[model samples]
Target: DVKVTQSSRYLVKRTGEKVFLECVQDMDHENMFWYRQDPGLGLRLIYFSYDVKMKEKGDIPEGYSVSREKKERFSLILESASTNQTSMYLCASSWDRGGQYFGPGTRLTVT
Candidate 1:
């Protein structure tokens, strides 16, 4: 079975602080993605990596960055978190176009 786990289920941060959200997958998937979910805006992709050290910007990448130094781990970095950036972050991994296995998600609050 494929398993994806996020470092935190909930996180709190102050405005302008840097934040790091981590995700790890056990399936050795070749693709990993980071997305942010908001009530009305729906799920917006932040970034994705097809392989180690390779990243591509997704729909909303203005305030976010990502790292995939290792095959099993992917990290999302918020350069400077803001109130508008507060949302539920989700990590997903997939081996092909079939489907993605998602993590529990991290609910981040920026005050």
Candidate 2:
């Protein structure tokens, strides 16, 4: 089965601190995504990369950035973490149109 693994299951950060979240998929899928899930808000796309070294920002990418230098790994960086950025972050990947497969999640708390 395909799987996605995130660096941390939960994180605690302070305002204005820099943060990094990492994700890796073993399925060798070409498409990967990062999103934040909030209560009643569902998944809001932050960024997605279709291929290695190529990426595109999604609906909400203001406070976040991503890197995808290799095919199996993608990293997300928060230049300056904020309370509003404290949300459940998800990593997902898929092949072609099979639909996104998700990681368990990373719950970030910022104060």
Candidate 3:
């Protein structure tokens, strides 16, 4: 089974604090992505890693960064949490053109 797991299901934080969201996939996927799903706006990409130690910026990577030092793990770092950044964060993993499998998203609230 293809499994993508998020480290946190829900998170609450104060403004300006650094936050880290972690994800892991059981399958050996080449593509791992971080995205946030907001009401009306749909899912927007934050970052993605196609190979270990390699990363790429997506649509909304201003407040975020990603790391893929290991094959099965990926991490999302939020430099300064803000109220505007409050949303559900989803982690996904896939192979070449493989359909994405989602984690049980982390709902982050920046108060």
lDDT of 3 by residue, 1-111 (tens): 888999999999999999999999999998999999999999999999999999999999998888899999999999999999999999999997858999999999999
Q: List residue ranges in candidate 2 displaced over 4 A.
A: none
> Compared to the true structure, candidate 3 yields what TM-score?
0.98
Residues 1-111 of candidate 2 have per-residue lDDT tens digits of 898999999999999999999999999999999999999999999999999989999999998999999999988999999999989999999888868899989999999
- RMSD of candidate 3 to the truth, in angstroms, is 0.6
Candidate 1's displacement at residue 79, Å, is 0.8
How high is the lDDT of residue 77 in model 2?
93
How close to the true structure is residue 55 of candidate 3, measured as C-alpha lDDT? 93
Alpha carbon lDDT of each predicted model: 0.96, 0.94, 0.94
Instruction: Predict model 3's lDDT versus the native.
Output: 0.94
What's the CA error at residue 84 for candidate 2, in Å?
A: 0.4
TM-score: the better of candidates 1 and 2: 1
Segments of candidate 1 deviating more than 4 angstroms:
none
Against the true structure, what is every candidate's RMSD? 0.6, 0.7, 0.6
In candidate 2, which residue pairs clash? Answer: none
